[model samples]
Target: MSSTWMTTRAWLLMLPLLAIMIAVIGWPMADTVRLSFTDAKLVGLGGRFVGFDNYVKMLTSGNFQRALYATTWFAVVSVTAEMVIGVLAALLLNQRFYGRAVLRALLILPWALPTVVNATLWRLIYNPEYGALNAALTQIGLLDSYRSWLGEPGTAMTALILADCWKNFPLVALIALAALQAVPRDITSAALVDGAGPFARFRFVVLPYLAGPLMVALVLRTIEAFKVFDIIWVMTRGGPANSTRTLSILVYQEAFSFQRAGSGASLALVVTLIVTVLAVGYGLLVRRAAGSAA
Candidate 1:
């Protein structure tokens, strides 16, 4: 009887959390799935089951295809660039020097800023008229005339990538820097004593230690970058000719602007699926890298 009472107490203890999960996550997920199969809209009370029509329509849309390509490109280029810059910054910061403490704190300022604010700041910087970038370029005679960075199709994504790198590389640097701290200094010193050049030392000793955390950072940044929305929205809003349209923007346009909740829900679920696959792939890679490093 005492054991039964103890078991009941444990059940009671779990009840609140179980209820919270059901209310917070599970309920919304269930609603989204259900909505994806219907013709729901923002103003509609009842929706008829359409049975994959939304998915079919979305898959057939050329605009959706463009968005997918843009999203993939953004995720790949931005994340790769950030990883490279971040890893280098981390290595530099790891070395002792004057003002290193102040610089370390400064590095985080960009990442600590609000994403929307970052986006807006970049938008101003890229503005064709009366922007600092244009003025500086003109003063240095780099450009004959001011160019609208975000307006041009060729430069829009590139501009966004640069801004994203500035905002996000700091976080990656922090992660890589932490990982670098765990590396054995003795190994690096030993390599230096063995006449290894800086390149060789990093290639052989430092990289081996960083492999696991680098993979972890890469996977995480990739996932985050893949679903990026707000920055682009605040800056370009997927812009002049839809060149910067990404999957997340597609969801926003369909759900909110187009008043098609079913399609929006479907698009969101698609994104969730893609992110899930990425997460699983990262998990496997992390385990393999960890095992190899160990």
Candidate 2:
């Protein structure tokens, strides 16, 4: 009877959380899924059952294809750059140095800043006239004149990727640093004593410890980058002939701009499904890596 009472108490404690999740997450997700199958309009409630028409339309749309390509490219480039740069920064900072703590704190400022603020700051820096980027390039003889960075189709996505890397690399660095802190110093020392060079030591001794954290960071950064919208909205607004428009922006434009709620809902579900699959794959890989390490 006492055991039964404890079990009941545990369930009672969980009830509120369960209720909140159902109300906030379950209900909306169900509604969105339902809407995705119908001819829903932003202005009306009487949506007829379309039965995958919206999905077919989205699949066939060239604009949707472009958005998917752009989003994929952005996520791939930004995450890869951030991972490489962040790992390097973490390794450098892990070494003994003067003012290390101050430098670490300073590095976090970019990540800690609000996304909109970071986007706006980069927008200013990329401005054609009196912008830091143009001025620097000119000063270094890289450019003959100040030119619009975000106003050109070719350079717009690249500029956004740079801005995103600046704001996000610190997160990866922090995660990597924490992993580095947990590494067995004794093993590293033994590797050094074995005449292992810096690269060999990092490869044989340090890399095993870093794999798990780096994978976690990669998964997180991939998901965030896939759904990136706010910064692009603030900085480029998916302009330069929609060269930088991503899936999130496409969904927004469909729902709000074109008033095609059904199409937007379908696209949103598609995005969610893609992210979920990618995350699950990463999760499985992490589990396998952990098992192998063990």
Candidate 3:
């Protein structure tokens, strides 16, 4: 077949999918953009156009600022912890040992669990009255009394972070483990023969192979972390004085709970913009890492 015919046929094959995407994603996004410019309610005739009023109000609001800070902190800390724990777990699992296969198979459990289920499990564990965590801590004499973990601002975010890490680190580990498999055994053996210590070997030899894949993992995790909603919502509902309120949670509260569709759409777009910037930045980093690896 001629090249033009092949291209035409490919476009024809993709036309249905493209139409579906436009219907499912494109139309809603365009409508959101329209709604964002008005002062619309969730259930009413669309309100009058308000220009950039919603954007200005949201940007200047203290609530938005706090939510942004909380979201940023959650994303940065959770992603960092996940990456570190994942790499360590990957390294440990990569070794030869009995029952390694069983353990490796078990690593999928947390990641495989539904987000709401995982959040609920953690919520029960953090329950002040009869929580596993509090019970264990008190039994070990680490605490005089069971404390409300999710009820305190000081510890709420940390608790959520830990839960998030548990659910997500497995994904990073799987990615890292796959990358580790590609590292040449001969190179590691040579490094060992050269008396390269574990840290030195990992830093100099293993890390180069892991970098590209880990970068991809990092980008995925970071974006997910930034927009986290369901887990936090299920666990805390951005409670303890909104200490755990993320951008997504804020958007939900504005759009649904408060029924301010216009401002909610504006807030959602702002979040989309932030996520887009992060994705672009991470994409650049991924390219750089790939170029370096090449």
Candidate 4:
């Protein structure tokens, strides 16, 4: 009876949050779906009753294709690198150290800093004439002349990936480290006592324990990475011939820069759909993984 009463109280407490979610999130999604069907303007009146024309134009547009490609590449590569580096960092942090607490706190700086500031710092680091990266490369005899990292089409996307990985991997590392700590000591010790190699033990025990948290991290990161804008905008503005242009950047260019509100909004909703699919897929994957683990 006490447990039943506590459950009832918990549901009552959650009612307000459920209401807020419906009002804020659900209503806006419904509106976006509605608006996508109509011809709307940025600052003017509604143009016409165009059903699916905006979406069709967006799908066929060359710029939108390029943006989709860029966004996909960025999400895949950056998230993969972040997961690998994060797991390694987590392993290292899980071990005992002379100044473990201080190191852990300091490592979070990248994750905690404002995205705009991170972009500014990275932009300066990539500057051709007087940036630190160029100076260091020259000093190391890798290059005879200073060259712009962000100004080159081939390297712009790669450079952005590196910057994003640096900023975000710390978050994954911290979460993984926490999960690693929760791993039982006896099981690991038994594996070591049985003469298992470090890699073997990690493969069999540690990885299984870490899998859930890692997947959660991957899903969250992928969603955010897919929609990234601020850092890219501040750093490169999707310039150097639109080489680094992503879906979200395309939305900005279309809506504000080009003043094509209906087309941009339509394009934006497609991105939203892609992200929603990713999120739903992740949810299903996570649920299956949890069940298997259980």
Candidate 5:
């Protein structure tokens, strides 16, 4: 009887959180799935259930295909760059040095800035006239003239990826650095005593400590990159001939701009599915790595 009472109390304590999750996440997701099967508009009440029409339309559309490709490319490039740069930065910061705390704090400033602010800042930097990037390149004799970085199809996606990497790499660096801190110092010292070079030590000793956290960071950053909207929206609005249009931007344009909520919901679900698959793959990789280490 006492155990039953405790169980009931525990459930009662969880009731408010359960109610909030249901109200916020569960209901909206259910409604979205329901709406995806219909011809719902942005500002409509009733709609006919045209089963699989939206999904079929999205799958058959070239524009949606392009968006998927762009989104995948953005996620892949940005996350890879972030992981590489972040691990390097984390390794650098991990060494004993003067002003390390100050430098570490300063390093986070880019990621600490709001996404809109970072996007706007990068947009201005990439501006054709009187932009810092152009001015620097011209002064350094690397460019004869200011180029429209975000206005060119070839450079728009690359520019966005660079800006995103700048803003997000520090997050991975922080994770990697924390993991590095937990590494067994005696093992690393033993490796050093055996005359292992810096690269060798990192590859064999330090990397094992970082593998788990880096995978988690990769999973998180990949999801964030896949659904990237604000930076692209503010910087290019997926312009330069729609070359930068990602799945999220496509969904936004389809639902709000074109007022095709049903199709938009369907596309959103597709993006979710893709992210979920990627996450699951990463999870399996993490598990395998952990098992191998054990």
Candidate 6:
């Protein structure tokens, strides 16, 4: 077949998908961009164009600043913890054991659960009254009484972080485990014969194999963490003085809860911009890592 004909046939096959994407994603995105520049409300006619007023206001607001800080903190801490715990879990599971298969299957449960379901489960576990966590801590002499895990500013963010990590670490573990499988047994055996310690084996022998996959996991988790919403919403609703308010939550409140569609759209766009920059930055890092590995 001619190259031009092949190209034409491919485009013809993709036409339906392209049209659906334009209708579903492209139109909404364009509408949102238009809405961001207006003074629109959730229940009114199209508001007048405000020409960056919404963006300027949102960008300068104290609430935006606080939300940004909370989001960054959550993303950094949760992703970091997930990566560490996941790699450790992957390493452990990589070893031959009697029930390694069972453990590996069970490791997927947390990641497999729906986010809302996981959040609800964690909420009950952290419940101040008759919650598993409080009961366990009290029995262990760790606490004098039950404490509200999601109710206080001091502990709300930390509690959210812990829940987020639990739900996400399994994904990282799975990725790492898959990468670990690709490492040649002979290479690992040679490293062991060379008298390398466990840490040295991982660092010099196994790590180079794991690096690329782990970077991919890192990028995925970081982006998800940055835009975290449903879990936090179901758990804390950004409550206890908005202590757990992330960028996504802030956007939700601004757009839906407060009925300021224009401002909310602007905030959402800002968030999209931030996420885009992060994705682009991570893409560069991943490329660099791949280049170095090559």
When sorted by lDDT, best at the front, the candidate numbers are 3, 6, 2, 5, 1, 4
Query: Better model by TM-score, 3 or 5?
Result: 3
RMSD per prediction, one decimal? Answer: 1.7, 1.4, 1.3, 3.2, 1.6, 1.3
Give the per-residue lDDT of model 6 (tens digit) for 213-238: 99999999999999999999999999
The global C-alpha lDDT for each of the candidates, from Candidate 1 onward, is: 0.92, 0.95, 0.97, 0.91, 0.93, 0.96
lDDT of 3 at 118: 98
**1-294: candidate 4 lDDT, tens digit per residue:** 699999999999999998999899989777666667777767788767789998988899898899999999999999999999999999998889899999999989999999999999999999987899899989999989998899999899999999999999999998899889978999999999998998999998898889888889999999999999999999999988999999999999987898767777788888989999999999999998788777
Deviating ranges (above 4 Å) for candidate 3: 1-9
Worst 10 residues of 1 by lDDT: 39-48
Q: Alpha-carbon error at 61 in model 1, in Å?
A: 1.4
Model 1 ranges off by over 4 Å: 1-8
- Local accuracy of candidate 1 as per-residue lDDT tens digits, 51-105: 9998999889998889999999999999999999999999999999999999999
Which scores greater on lDDT, model 1 or model 5? 5
All candidates' TM-scores? 0.95, 0.96, 0.97, 0.91, 0.95, 0.97
lDDT of 3 by residue, 1-294 (tens): 899999999999999999999999999999999999999999989699999999999999999999999999999999999999999999999999999999999998999999999999999999999999999999999999999999999999999999999999999999999999999999999999999999999998999999999999999999999999999999999998999999999999999999999999999999999999999999999999999899
Instruction: Looking at model 6, report the run of 10 residues with the lowest lDDT sum.
Output: 285-294
Q: After superposition, how far is residue 118 of candidate 4 from its true place, in Å?
A: 0.5
Q: In model 4, which runs have C-alpha deviations exceeding 4 angstroms?
A: 1-28
- In candidate 2, what are the lDDT values of residues 90-186, reduced to their tens digit? 9999989999999998989999999999999999999998899999999999999899999999999999999999999999999999999989989
lDDT of 4 at 157: 92
Model 4 scores a C-alpha lDDT of 0.91
Deviation of model 5 at 15, angstroms? 2.7
